[model samples]
Target: MRSLADLNKQGVVSFGEVIVDYISNNKDNTSFKQFIGGATVNVAVRLARKGISSTYLTKLGDDEDGVFVKEELVNEAVNMNECSMTTTKKVCKVYVHQNENGDRIFHSYQNPTPNEWLLDSEINSHIFIDTKVTYFGSGTLFHEKSRRTTETILELAENFHQIIAFDTNIRLKRWESAELCKKTIAAFISRAHIVKMAEDELLFLTNTNSVKEGLAVAVKWAIPYLFVTRGKEGAIALHNQQYISTEGLNVTVVDSTGAGDAFMAAVIETFHDKGLPQSKTDLEELLTYANGVGAKAVTKMGAL
Candidate 1:
């Protein structure tokens, strides 16, 4: 296992599904445009764009959609050496519907090979040998195979003493029940050093009515860093018993598909560059920068 000093010199490993996003090009949901997307994929690409070395880890099919996703990641300079390729795993597809305000609504998902995932047996300490941070989302937690894989990776991350960053990018439709989703996410949260979630996600998980109540409930998890993002309104963060807020940047809305992912990337990049902020002032500045990155993401058509 690498020490903290050695890990600081390494890059981030983003693990999750890489899906094809079919975005509705019109308010009537007629025309559509396909983009390489997924929460972790977006974070990996954005980190690469910011000159942060990023390695994407996921199992991809040998099909055309998988090839397209791989090509796009390569184009953005994200490393794929740690990724897996197989013939049995088909790429996941999701339909994104956008309102006039440019906010995205996940309409539906088409997954032909939901059972296929990077097996726990395929994972080893070598994957985290040069990884300073390991980032993931809850999308894979609903599946038994992927869930076990996630657990294996989390164990390796802990053993390596790498920063564990988690995003509760919850999709209710993916889980069998709301209770199961909450239970699974809570288990992961307990293992994470840093956690990012939308304001609504926070509320849902805590079963609270407001952000304050949600934060109050979540602080008990003892996570080192917690961020709650509010679209357009900006974000709030809690660290070391201090709460700090930052206002969102004013940007024209084009598509809100990957805004949260961009925000997560920016925050991770900041942590990569300068270890976790030690003061409330520093944490506020970090959140402010992350807010800007998220705002910029919404000004583009695709998540990248």
Candidate 2:
């Protein structure tokens, strides 16, 4: 198996929803900011920033937000040629409310929208031919039409024997029910070689509060590697049968919006660089680096 570094950065691609995150200011109801978002594309952009080339595949509307997001992707050096389009644009409305003590609350609006209309025509075997990985965003896995398209993309990726990665970027509102989400995630788990999950997502996937119990699910599914994210507590992972955990760094968080996306992006890059860790020390270093990436993301406003 060739690592991402081995492919010289040409073989990594991110596939799924690509939309705009409209961040509204709660203090001033009239003001807002727009950031290019969508978990899978964020990974592609992050990889590009880190000097890796990656293709972003998704559908955008021929509208203002879509144009803005496309321009942002261009600035990020992510390939736009592989992306498709729709007639209506889709966006996530994120309201950031704050209390006197400076604590913040986020209310988000993300559902079946234009981005979910990604078509099968937008993909083919050639996308994975030179790619070492075809990473999918879980946000696109709930919709029937988009999920079918995603499954088709994965089929092509698998046919090429590319590394298939999945992130349980599980936002409950994206699915019909929690039960359905779990079923969908499990199906993805069975298909992917790498899985990136938040601790809460791990609990849901494992159906138990205990990390040990959750790990058992990974073993049951024959998942080779599982990365568990723990916000400020850092992260833990089970590689093959070895367990590795890394400590968190002290950083003042600005907006923790896309921290998980950044962390997963690093995980993909690191996995690309060396395939997988050969020793406990190597694994720990990777976790430490991933933690730093997540920390850095919080210091920024959006996912990218």
Candidate 3:
């Protein structure tokens, strides 16, 4: 018989933004439903929910929302040893719009706060010495200090032979321009061992209108594996030279708040459950599980 204790898994570390997401029901109403968000944060919390320990690295503000975010992390059992709080804070808002069929679209976003101080703290590779994987979001590049911090982590990962994952969570509203975003995203993808992004991010990175053209661009990157989320169309995985796409699940989306994050967390959990796929069939099966995880995530109100 399989012991239940055998199900417990090793923890992972996530580095990047930690934002308070204010999700509105409609474009007209900007008030309702608040949650602790940010792509990597979502991944960490979900992994924790799956019985995995997670060390979160980022800076929070010494404010109400920051306290709320801290409490949420505590409730989820995410390690906050690397997390710090400063004197100031900012909240990011997501105005959501849903199609009649329950597809969520983030119509607008505003992020007036930034965390440059978090990067000032020297990088400590020792803290991640035993972590299962080190995951981060590309949005961290928007700031000079945070960008250096990200690059440093990648460097340490390379030196230590640690697994590194990157999520290209492109929020157009926060970028100065799409071209700059693409340049930075492309650079990060080239260095990551595992990369994940939504279908739209592929389009932006490739500057194309069609998925096929976008894939042509996606495949050129140096990443060992790539995960692309396509909402109702499910997700596709590119490993080695093969591409495997799984059918999307039908779910009534309350909000698309953390669908991609959930998908990435599932991918990590799958890798933890079964070592990173070594064959084409294994990759396909892994992506199918990821799509299912993403679908289930949308049935809720926020990332968690």
Candidate 4:
């Protein structure tokens, strides 16, 4: 059986924001639920839940919220060798709104946290030397120190036989301009071995509403694998000169907060299970499994 520990032993390191997700239920008077989140963090949790030994690299304030976040990571069994508490900024929080259609919108509160906090530590490549895969989120690329840190890490790992995955988890409100977001995200996509873009996200990034056109653009940039997730309709994946589509599972939706992250976790798990460099048929299976996991995630209130 493929185990999370096996993947970890081989090497998997996730670099991104680790935030406290403050979620509110649209039903039952909009009660709140707090969960440890952020895109890569959510994927790391799911990987750990499946027995993968994963390490999360991010910063959190040395406060109650930070305590909660750390406790959650420990409970999930994610490697925290590089995680640290920052005295400079409080932990970031994302407040989410789940509409009746199960779509989620979010407002973020940031602390001007710098990526130097992580680089200044003992994060030698040897610690993640075994890591065969490195995952990063686009949000971190918005800040210079953090973006440079992520870029440097990827540069360092380039010599290693590793697949670099980038999730274009765009937050336009966090950037200074739309042009900057597009430029930075496009640059990352051009280099990523695997890239995931939502239907709406492609429209925003490419300024093109057509999926075919957007994917064509992605292909022109030389991205090896491109996944376009269309909410409700399902997701389409392109790999190795073939296109495969997976229909979304039918389920009662509550909050769609973590669905995409869940989908990502499932993709990684399936890829790890099948071993490196999957065929088109293998890609289809992975996308189907990921969609199921994503559908199930929306049935709950939080990212967990």
Candidate 5:
């Protein structure tokens, strides 16, 4: 395994959308509060907070919401040198509603300039020169232009010999159809070195009723590492065709908006610090720590 010292110079690059989340402040969903949030954004910020060097790559609109997102990333000490700013791209906005149990529900999304995204021609390979791992999700794949850009980045990452981590942070509303969503995600999964998905996502993609069955189907993808996270039930990992599970933490839940992103950050951090797991024991430890990080994220109101 590579030592931490050998990997400290290389950071993780997070590529996806950054949205201004307008969360409901009351049960009626009438009142709202704005927060900088997104799946990949939360992961990048959480990784920075954990003292890991993190770089965020996304195209932001030169608007107030975009400015707010940039300032927040700056406050979190996340590197944004590769991020793009343009007047054509409006920062995406999402409305989050909470149930009685404080679980987040995506009520709606507003994006006036849906087609504008980071273009493949604008992407510079230098961004991955010091990157050990490149992380992305399926949120941006709904757009044709963005999907091409994503493919380009993934190809570049592969050429650079960087670890590719894919988080199937599925937002069904973003895609036109569930069939398309599943097909696109499967294509990406085949290229990932590590894959993370919620238990619900596992069932959706594999059409399985249980985690074990889901793993049995996904194992054919031949991904080096696969994790299925079950909220409050802990998590499960499938490595080398073997499965291991862990119990979730019991904590007072305030909000569950960014829990999964926190878990992804923890997983990436472990890989950065210790390289890939050498044994089942090593994989088990990664799951336990990731579950704890996810549990801790829900104790707060906002993702950051």
Candidate 6:
């Protein structure tokens, strides 16, 4: 069997929701700042920017917001032929509220929204089959319809023998209960070959405070590699019974909004374009590239 590095070097196919972020920096702001965002969509765009051929699969509405998001992806040269449109709801919007500590509190509106209620017919099986890597985040698994759609995509990806990469992008407020979020995310975790999780996510998914104990639980699912992200402390990967650590690039903190997404994008692009994960040298090189990308993302306000 070919390794994940070989598969990623071939290219990638990503599936998830693409949302228009309606953000505000002022308390009584007359209008909000809009940015094209969504975890998988950002990954696809960044991959394209890095000269990787990327296919983005998802549903968007025919509304103005949706048009803007699609146009942004098109402008970035992402392959969006697998994307669909529904005229029912406007695009998904995320309203951001900041606390005194500068931590963002998101108020999202999504319930049977056009994108969330995607039909399986909207996606093309051939696209999934042709891609070397199929990536997605757990955010889209909250709703029943979209959850089912995500599951179907995973099944098709397995059939196509694609390398399945999952990001444990747990959003507590999106689900009805923390228990439910853990359960659903575990289902996807069991299916992924490569998993990217944060330090806090280790505690949430495993109910443990230690990364080692958390990794023990994650390894039980037979995931080949696990990357644990430690903000500013850098990232560590547990693979082949060795710990590969990389230090973060020192940079001014403007907004930490899309740093992780940027890092994920860099890793995926490196794997797809350069057949990485072959050696520790390759891992270190990619980590260095990702650190640069992540640091660059914070200089901007939102995901592009």
Instruction: Return the TM-score for each candidate structure.
Output: 0.95, 0.89, 0.90, 0.90, 0.95, 0.90
**For residues 1-304, could you state the per-residue lDDT of candidate 4 as single tens digits?**
0112323335468887787777876533266777778899999999989987787887766778677778878888998777866676567767776565646777555555543345534356775567767788886888877787787777755656566778888888778798999999888776677788788897787777698777666556666777778877899888765678888778887778878888888877766555654466677777888888888898877787
Candidate 2 deviant stretches above 4 angstroms: 1-9, 24-31, 92-106, 110-116
- How do all the candidates rank in terms of lDDT, highest first? 1, 5, 3, 2, 6, 4
Q: Mind giving the per-residue lDDT tens digits that candidate 6 earns over 1-304? A: 2233335336688888877676667545345787778778888888888777888887777888777778889889898777887787566667766656665556565545543556676767878656778899987788887888888888888877778888887778788899999999988887877788888898789888887787777666666667777778788777766677788778776667667888888777766666538888877787777777877887767866
Q: List the global CA lDDT of all models.
A: 0.88, 0.77, 0.78, 0.74, 0.87, 0.76
After superposition, candidate 1 runs with Cα above 4 Å error: 1-7, 100-102
Off by over 4 Å in 3: 1-9, 91-93, 97-103
TM for candidate 3 is 0.90
The TM-score of candidate 5 is 0.95
TM-score of 2: 0.89
Clashing pairs in 1: none
The number of the candidate with the highest lDDT is 1
**Candidate 6 overall lDDT versus native:** 0.76
Error of 2 at 103 (Å): 5.5
lDDT of 2: 0.77
Worst 10 residues of 1 by lDDT: 1-10
Can you list the residue pairs that collide in candidate 3? none
lDDT score for residue 302 of model 1: 90
What does candidate 3's lDDT look like per residue over 181-201, in tens digits? 888888787777788988888
Residues 199-293 of candidate 1 have per-residue lDDT tens digits of 99999999999998999998888888999999988999988767889887888888899999989999999998898787777898899999998
Task: Report the number of backbone clashes for model 1.
Answer: 0
> Where does candidate 5 stray beyond 4 Å?
1-9, 100-102
Clashing pairs in 2: 4-272
